[model samples]
Structures are given as C-alpha cells and as structure tokens.
Target: MNRTPEPMSRRPELPFHWTLVLLLALSVVLAACGASGAPSNAPAAEADQERPIKIALMAPLTGGAAAVGEPQLNFVRLAVEQFNAEHGTNIELVEGDTELDPAKATTLAQRLLADEAIYAVIGPAGSQEVAAVAPLLAAADLALVSPSATKPDLTEQGLPNVFRVVPRDDVQSATVAQFLLQRLAATRVWLIDDQSSYGVGLVDAIEAQLRAAGVAVVRESVGQDETDFSALVTRMRADQPDAVFLGTQVASQGALLARQMQEQRVQALLLGGDGLMTEDFIANAGGATEGAYVSFFAPDVTNLPSAQPVIEAYTSRHGAVGPFGPPAYTAAMVVLEAILRASAEGPLTRAAVRDAIAQTNQAESLLGIPIAFDTKGDIQNASFFLYQVQGGAFVPAR
Candidate 1:
C-alpha cells in the first residue's frame, strides 16, 4: 500500500460510546464464546477461526471530555462491526473509560495489559491520558492507535507500539498560526491554555509561532475543570486583542468561555484547536460559537464520498458527526486491518500486529486522504484543516 502524498483538491469525496450497553452485551457473548473453547487437538487455523480477537477503545467515556470520547467509542464500534461482517471473523470490541484522567488511564492500561486477548487499542483521547498509558502499553508491547492525541512527544519517545492518525501539535499549531496571521489578519492574539497536556503543549507551540512572526501575544492559563471565565473575558476586553486562541481538550469548557466572552462584550475573534470542534461546544455555546474557528488535523468526512457509507451508518444510529469520530474510525481501521494481515500469516501476536501496522498504506482513507506511517509510527505527510462554525455547523473556513 505504498503511496505518495496527494493534494487536498484531488482527494475523493470524503459517539455515544454506548459504553455500558456494549460492555454488558460483549461480556455475555465473550462468556459464551469462552465456554465453548476449542479442543486441545484442534488445528491452528481452526482454533484461530473460532477464537475471538479483541481490540480495546480507551477514551474518556464518563467525564467532562466524554462529549469527544463518546463519538470516538461509537465510531470504533462501527469500524469493528463492518470488518466482522465483511470478513466473517469474530472480532470483539471492548471499551475502557479513562474519564480524561491520567491516573484512571494508568489503571485502564494495567487492565488491558492483563487481558491477553486485546492485541491493540484505539484511543485514550486526551494527550495527557496517552502520555500516562503509553509507557505501560509500550512495556507490554501492546499496540496503541490514538485518533486525537497529537502531542509531538507521544511519538518521539521511541515507543514502537504507539501510533496516531492525526498530525502533531507542531504541525497543527503552525497551520493555525498561519491562518491567524494571514487569513484572519490577527496582529494581537491572546492565547489561553486549559492546563491539560494537550492544551499546554498546543498553546506553547502557537505562542512561539505568533511571537516569531512579531505578533503581540498575551498568554494565560486556566485549570482544566474551571468553568468561570469572567476574569479572562475582562482581560481580553481590556487588551482588545484581534483574536483569542483557546487550547482546551474539554469541549464544554470552550463553550463556557465563548459564552462568557459574549456576555462580557469582548469583540475578539475566538479560535481553538481540534479539541473544541465538537457538537457540545456548538450546542452549549448559546450561539456564541458562530464564526469561531477550529484547526483540525482531519477533514470533514461528511463531504468525502469515500466516507459516505460509514457516515450514513453512524448518523443513522447516532446523530450528526463531529471532528473526532472520523479519525477514530480511521484509527480503528488501521489496527483492525493490521490484525487481519497478521492473523492471515500465522498466529496473531502483539509483535506481529505492531509490525503490520508499521506497514500500513491506505491509498485513500475515510477522509479521502492517503494514509501511511513513517518509521516513527506517525502518519506520513499528515496535514491539518481549518473550519469555522457558521449557522451552528463547522464548515471549511475558506
């Protein structure tokens, strides 16, 4: 599946994690399957065919970030369902709720490590969660494919088993900074971090880029759980900056900030990273999100013809799609495809799946972009896009 990078114009048309319901159902099915174990003398191929191959989706399924994690979980389930139906192989999808907490993610990592049946993981959506679990999973040699975690250090640590479908923060922040300086003509920008690993890293990158361009930058930090932004809004109003960039993983917090800005009569334009590109942000912003901009690593799959089937299936069950779901689908596809490739050759082991993932080369993904991994396990030639919320929907910013 070797492919050269393609330009955007040439591309093809491109979660309630339903966590508790899925867990109970999968538990029963798994119990039944385990009860009917194959005989000791069964052939290797027979045993493999009968055995269930499991992959875990680790996301913030029950916390403030659940808005983003729910879609991620659901989309991974969609991918697993489609793969199982097409291949007639039993692949069990499991869920691990990290609740957007690093400590919780660490515990979940240990649980997954103990479950020898799970060969790979789809997420631990937040960057901090990924950081917390990456070492443990790496030590165990369990493959991890994160759809939303974009911290550059996640891949730079030489963890062979960690992979992601999105561009790194450096790439995303530079792209956003370019849009601010060129497209938005922003001269004075106020940068805010939600104090999470994702927010702090992204804000730092954007701040450096803006400062390098001779743009005036005002930097601030807020707690991840903080909801009140009155003081920040007052400061922004006084500074009268051209735009405010929020680097927060919690979508609702972004919404709250936006509403508070509007209430305080701050005229500065609002911009955010991929984490704020969710339905929760739009719906909860009380119409303040209109015209707000978000820089995302993946394109809107609703516009990609190649992604029509998956999008239709997802929307039929769930509602409209968001930025994170499509990437999660892509991540799931990468891991599942690699698992099949490994299983076809011989017994499927974590090492074999990890090696197979390294060889991934999809000519066109759901977003209609070519997918391939470099030596570091990051997607090759990964890029980002800009979307603006208009009339309550995220559309290409133009």
Candidate 2:
C-alpha cells in the first residue's frame, strides 16, 4: 500500500470561457436588482395613471332653457364634488351647452369625442338633442346617461350606450292620461304640443290613450318659442275642454300659456310635463299657475330623505333644486360609480365603462327610487309624479 499511492481522484474545473459566462450572467442579475431598489424616474407612465378623469355635461346651458340646464350642471357638479371628497377620485366636468338644438348637440358630441380624456356624458337633456348625438356616442362606445331625455325610441333603438334616469314618454303619457280620466275626471281634454320631439312624443301617446278610453280629445301644436298663446287660449275657452295638457319643454311657454289662459278666462285645468316642473314655471307664470298640475319624473328632492344632504349643500350654493336637478344628480352618480368600477377591473376604456353602466343596480338613488337599467337602457319600473301648484308651491297630488 505504501508503494506508489494511486493518483488522487479530483473534480474537473469549468473551462475558463464557461466560468466567464456564468460570472457575467450573475453580475447582470445583481445589477438589475440593485437598479430596481431605486425610485423609478418614469414620470410619463406614472402621470398617465394618476391623471384626473374627465366627464362632460351636455345641457342647454344657454338660451330659453338655461334655467333648467343650469341646475342640471350644478347638481352633477355637486355629485362629482362629493364623490371626489369621499372616494379620493379626481373628476373634471366639462360643460357642453346643447341649447335645445340637436345640431348644437351633435357639435358638442363631436368635441367631446375628440377629447380622449372624456369617458362619459351626463346628458343631452332634451330628447331631440339625445337623438342627435346618440348615434355618434354609440359608435364611439361612449356611455350617455341622461337625466331627462324621455323619448321611448331613444333607448328602443338597440344602442348599447344610451341610458336615462327618467321614465319614457310612453310610460309618462299613460300616467298623464290616467290622471286626466281618474284624477281630474275630465270627459273632454285638449292636448297641445310644443312641436319639439319631447312634446310630440308625449302628446301622441296621450292622445292615443285618450281616444281609446272614450275621452274626447283635441290635438294642437305650437312652436317652442311662441310667446303669443292667445289664439290657443281663446280656442280652449270656446271648446271648453275639462283640462288643457301643455306638452311644452319651454318653461316660459308654459308660463305664457297659463297667463294667457287666465286673461282669456279659460277655466280649464292646466297640466304640463316635467320640463315645466321647475320653479321657473311658477315664478314666470305670475300667479297664473295656481291650481295647475305638472307631472315630474321624481318627487321634489327636498321631499326625499336620501336627498336631504345633497339638497342642503346644493341649495346653499346654487339656490334651489328644480325637478331636473335631482335626476341629473342620480345620472352623475350612476356614471361615476360605473367608471370607478370599470377602473377597478383594469385600465379604463369607454367600452368598459359603458358595460358597467348597463349593468348598474343601485339599491337606492338620490331620487329615493331603486335604480336599475333594463336591456333597453331605460330605468326599470319607471314612474312619474304629479304635483299641483297650490299656495305658490308644488304639492304632490293624491
């Protein structure tokens, strides 16, 4: 054994080239880890994620309907403020004044679409305005949540992005017809339309119902801007209809009609749609709207428990809440909630936000109504409220 010791077995060493390669790879990984520990300087990417979301409010912020449109914008602003404060969101509201013109609304819609930051639209408050912009909005996959556009065909067109908080004209028309027959016990009624899309749709539906119910009905039309309703008032006096249903969206027109009726000694009860349910109607009527009835989509927000804080805060800054304001608030709420939800799932896109809005189910809304959307983008189980102008205030009619 002591003779020549066997050569000691030994492990072979890696080749020099292979050793260098492994060392290089290890250094690269360590360098990457070291670099990752430092703060990133990619401001563009981070800023993109943190930028404020933009929402557009399309309403008649100027012209005759400014009174109605102002409140709509204000309520939506209030909603956005509250949402921002409570949930740490940043939303910038851009105003698009549709001014009761469909052409104007289309222009505004195009502008909104051009802005990549705008994810949703609050309204094109009138039905005609909604109709004008809906195709473009639908094509672009942008969500449109209207507070007051009630034309039935708007949601019936199978457009995936159109949604409204108020009941459709058909539903409202049925309610109006029933009120005429049951509440007013009117055997003969006169229906007048302002010749706008909203007015035409409402009057058409109501007239059909009236004829079917064996109620004698007279149909008439007037321009929205018509200030002289004397002829119509005289005709009503001659016809001696039990009630005069004014399907006008122009508050001033409603006031003018009521005033002329008073002057002409027309004793028929005056009734108007939601567009005339604002304080402007009563104020501009100059005591002529007394004992008159107006139907609205929601009970006065001042009367809702859920809307108290909103009403208080809004009134403190913006004066009074109108029939149009609460619905806009609810619309804003629906859009904002859907946006937040879509954001949570992943990166925000108009299509995703639209789908989220379509799936909305609010346990309760600012109007104190349970909010949910049908397949048609119309609110499910929608209804209307009738209020009588009693003692210079709107009192819910029984």
Candidate 3:
C-alpha cells in the first residue's frame, strides 16, 4: 500500500484569471448594496410626483356684470390653456362664481383658501367684491390679482397681497376729466351716479377734478333701477351742462339714461366710465350710444404687439373680441409667472408663491410693458385712455 501512494492524484487548482473574476464579482455586488443603502434625491422625486399647481378664479359668472366678467373668465381660461399646452405642465383652474355680490365673494374666497391646493387667486371683477374678499386672502397669506377692479382704495388699503391689472379710478377719472375739459373744451359738467360703489367713486373723483380744473359742475343726479329718467334729464337740461358723466354700470340704468337723454333731445355730451365699455351698452341703448365717451383701463389690444397673438388666440377660441381681454390675460400671466418662480426650486407652496408675487418687479407682460408694484401694491405708472362710442363701438379718443 505504500507503493508510491499510487502517485497521489494531482488536484487541479483554480486559474489566476478565475480568482480575479470572482473578486470583481464581489466588488460589483458590494457597490450595488452601498448605492442602495444611501439617501436618494427623494425630495425632488416626491415633488415631481406631487399634485399639479392650482389657481382659483373668482368672478361674476352669473350676474348683471356677467357680460363683462364672462369675457374676463374666458380670457383667463384661454391663457391657462395656452400656457399648459406649451409648458408640458398642468395648471388646475378652479372657478367660483361670486355673482358680483360681496358676501358671495367672501364665501367663495374662503372656500378657495381652505383648499390648500390653490397657490393664487385671479379675481372678483368688481371693486366692491375685491373689497370684500381682500381681507380673507390677506389673512390666509394668499395672493389676489384682480383684472378689473379699479377703485383706488383697493391698493390704498395697505393690503400687501392685493393687486390689480387695471389702473385705479383716480387714473381713469383724471384722464377722462382732462379729455372732457381740455380736449373737448367743456366748460360745464353734469354728473350722475347709480349709487353703486364704482359709480359713486368714479363720479366723485371726476367731479372733483372737473371743479379743480375750473369746469362748472352744473348738476349732479343719482338714480337706480329706474326705467324713466325724464325728471333727471329735465334737471340736467335746465342746468345746460356741456357734458354729462354716466358713472354707472352698463347693465344698471345706464342704457336707459342714454336712451332717455337722446329721446328727450338732451344734447349734453355723454360720458361714462369703464362700466360702459361693453357691447351690451350699445346693444341696449342703440343709436343713443353714438358720440358717447368712456374711460377705461382697457389697452388697445390690436396695437400692442405682444398682446396681438393672445388676442388672436382668444378671438379664435370664442369667435369674438373679449372685454377686459388684455387685463385678464395679463392677470393669468402674472399668476403663471409667480407659480413658475415659486416652483422653480421645488413644489409650489402658497406662502412662497405669495411672496414671489409680492416681490415681482418690472416683469414684461402681454401689454408690451413691465409690470411692477409700488409700496401700495399698485402699478406706479398706471395710465388710462379715453374712448368714444362711434357706430356703437369703442374707438380711441385720447
């Protein structure tokens, strides 16, 4: 048995290359395990999976001013739709009808703020409504950008979160007063108000300016919900004013007044505020609207190169030009810009977005100008234009 131990069978050893291969395999497994155990870019991933940004739009969808507010809402919708189409991001729009009522506006604003998803709110078309809802939005640290509320007191209230696209009534009334006094050389003015916030405020401002400019305020009248203006027209005629200012909404006794003035042959120059800058006024008042004057924050959309495309797109969508088109579109753009600026680094938070809006300065907008807010959150260089109703259409007068 000790016969050379049968020449112990030589065992085959693993090749050097095979040992190196095993080591490499172990290294790969260890690397993978280390990578999996480490913290990820989890915040970014979670943010990407979060819900889309939301903006709440409050307006008078069904009320006397619906004629104006509906077009404004349409413009906002069109803007958001176009923006989403190009950006590959979703913007959820929630619309609440305030019915042009202050209490209803407050209710809708509260609901919008409670959602926790809305980063910003667009509007309550009327100044009265804005006055109602601004406190709630300011309390909740939410931003509100109104398209058509032009009351000066809105920005003067020292509300940090409140903003408006339209120029204040101070601007509009001053410009219109200048046009009536300097341009038209009207010596005597007669003013009328429907007793609404907008009406009273505008008339008061205009009357003050007219009086300061040495134009005599011959007569002042207040009327509401009345189909007959015979007494008012008789008094206005007695005063023999050179011009008459109709500081009332188009849908509220304005058309009737214009019609009565024409019917009774009261030859005073008819003047109005942006509230009369609607086709409904012309449609309801008919030939009486001819030669009427109005002051509005409405920019000349056709002349604004940057806004032309937006106007065209809107017209294509609705088959007609929109009222408050430029302002409404600009409001949506401002909200969109705020959302982008806030969400650029992370998920859009309401507080961050509101801050971004408050800090916005000199942003180029669809109006082909930079939009910046002053200490009062009002556009510092805001201006208004005068228009005349010629052939039942608003044509630039100044």
Candidate 4:
C-alpha cells in the first residue's frame, strides 16, 4: 500500500481509497494472517502485480460543445480499452464533465482532485475550462494532457503540469493567417470571437499575425450564446472585407455567424480555427459553411494509414471521429506511458507520474507524429493544417 500515493492507500491487501476505520480493520486482518495463511513473498508479488490507477477525462458532455467533447471522450475511452487489452496495466478512466463552462470546469476539477485515486486528467475540452482548473490542479500536483485546448497563454503560464497534444493558438492562428494572406490574397479581414478563453486567445493571435503580415484587421467580441448575428453581419457586409475570421467553436456562435454572413450576403470567405472544424458546423450553418476554410491542429486524420484502425473502431462504436478524437487518443496514450514508466522506476505517486509525463518523448503515436514536450509543456514539432469545407465535409484546402 505504501507503493501508491499516501493519500489513497495504507493497506497492503486492499486497493487505495477506503475509510480509515475500514483500513484499520483490514490491517488487523492482514496482521493476523500467519505464514500458512499469507505467502511470505506477498510483498514482492504485490510489487510485480499491476496496480490500478485512475485517470479522468474532463470534457463538456452535456452543453454546447458536446458535439466535439463527446468524440474526445469516446476516443479517450477507446485508448483506455486498447491499453488495457494489450498491457497488464490496470488503468481506470473517470469522467469529469464541465458542460463547456469554465465555472463548471472548476467545480468538476475540485471534485476530481478530492478523489485521491485520480492522478492525471485528459481534458476539459476548452482553453477556458483548462484555465479555470489549472491553478487548482497545479496546487494538487495533478498533471493534465489537453487534447483540444489551444490557448497559447495557458502553456505560457509556466505551469509544468499543463501539457497538451494540440498545437498552441499562436501556431494555429499564424498558420491560418499566412494561408489567407498568401494563398487567398486576403487584404482586409474582419475578426469575431466569443468571450471564451479559447476564442479570445485565438483571435488575439490571429489579429497580431494578420497585422504583422500587413493585412488590415478588424476585431469584435460577442457572448457565446448570442445566436442572432444580423447586426454583426450587417456591419461585416458594410466593411466587405476579403474574409471573416471567427475564433469560436462550432456549437457556440461560430455556426450562427457563418449562417448570418450568408443570409446577409456577406461575400467574404469564412475562416476559423480547429473549433469550427466539426461536422456540426456545416450542419448547423447549412450551405453557408461551404468553401469556409478551417485551420486545424492536423490534416484529416481519417486519411492517414496510421489512423485507419482508430477511425474504424471509433466509427463502429461511437459514430464518426472528429478532429479532436485522434489527439484525445494520443493524450491518453501519453499519460499511460508516463504511468508505466513511473511505475517501473518506483511507486506510482502523482509526483512520479508528473515527472514522467514532463519528460515524455514518444517517437511515434497514432497521430503518426513524434511526441515530445518542451520546457513550457507545449508539444514539440507541432504542425497545423488548413482545411476547407467542401461538399459538406472537411477536406485539405490545397
């Protein structure tokens, strides 16, 4: 029991997470066991035995971002299953839904921390949620691997525990801005974003990139629930910029902005980051999403040979995989590897696993890319790809 974290385990025979009184009774029972009753090498056997560890996946399973968060959740579960099937490690996954709100994420994170069994977390789906829970997680020594949160400042905060599989907002924003500036020849651009942390962060990066590239940038901020964008659309129509950049999610207000732009006859090309790359965006915006460009963390994953099996498994069990699915799988894989590596060295404590995760350097993963972390916890060698909504689906822009 000393092999596990102090907060969780104290009894040898029983797993972690039990009341003190119950643990005392179990201790007495173990103490009474004679040489014939309990094996002399039980302690050695226990060390070799695979101990159970719990990892939580924090995402919005109930609110607006559910369309995207649900797929991420599924992929995390699939990763757990695949890991369990292939290895002797006993890893359990817990769900901590934030409902797409940072406040909710904070509450859920507190609950997850209270459960001493959970040493690491996968996501809270959005950068706002991650921001809300980051300080709390660092205080408790819980490491996190975000699959989709792309806000640049979160990793910039110097919290060594905050790691993410996706590229930062700056990388994504610059990639999209350059694509528009050089390829589409966009000169004047209008920028709109929800007031969420993820949205505002991407907008700030994109705005800076556009101005640096000599493209005129106009900026606006809106509430996440403000669906009716007629006034905004009219304003955009008046400007008649070469393109409109929406830094928001598919389920929040980006889809609505796309629809209103089309309804108001705003002819500018619609562009966005990974948040708008979901199929729900096209479905909700209808024909308005056609020809809209999206800057995503990676190219269409379903096309990759390394992704075919994951795609098939995801499709067969939980319908089609989204842009965030493969990254979620990678996030889980990274955490599991950290746990295995830490356990190999010594007892599996939160500190040990956090250290292991910080030193991660996977040569290959299902994402078909090298995975490593810099001093800032940003995934190194990150690549962002541009995609276009063509024929109601996301395809490579070029």
The TM-score values for the models, in the order shown, are: 0.73, 0.74, 0.76, 0.74
Candidate 2 local accuracy as lDDT?
0.87
Which candidate leads the pack in TM-score? 3
List, residue by residue over 1-398, the lDDT tens digit for candidate 4: 55755654553654322443353464455446533456567774573354348898898888787887888888999999989888976799977678889998897787777655677999877888889899999998999999988777899888879999888868887787778788889999998888887789888888888898888888999887787889988988888899988888645366778888888888999888777766688888778788888888865778889778878988998886667688889999999999889989997788888889999999988788989999888999887988888898889877
Q: Which is better, 2 or 4, measured by lDDT?
A: 2
- State, as a TM-score between 0 and 1, how close model 3 is to the true structure: 0.76
Better of 1 and 3 by lDDT: 1
Per-residue lDDT over 173-207 for candidate 3, one digit per residue giving the tens place of the 0 to 100 score: 88888888778899988888888877888888888
Q: What is the C-alpha lDDT of each candidate?
A: 0.87, 0.87, 0.78, 0.82
Question: In candidate 1, which residue ranges exceed 4 Å CA deviation?
Answer: 1-50, 101-104, 185-200, 216-269, 275-289
Cα deviation at 9, candidate 2, in Å, is 81
Give the worst 10-residue stretch by lDDT in candidate 4: 14-23
70-131: candidate 1 lDDT, tens digit per residue: 99989999999998999887889878889999998898788777666789998889888888
RMSD for each model, in Å, please? 11.2, 17.5, 17.0, 8.1
Give the count of colliding residue pairs in each prediction. Answer: 6, 0, 0, 0
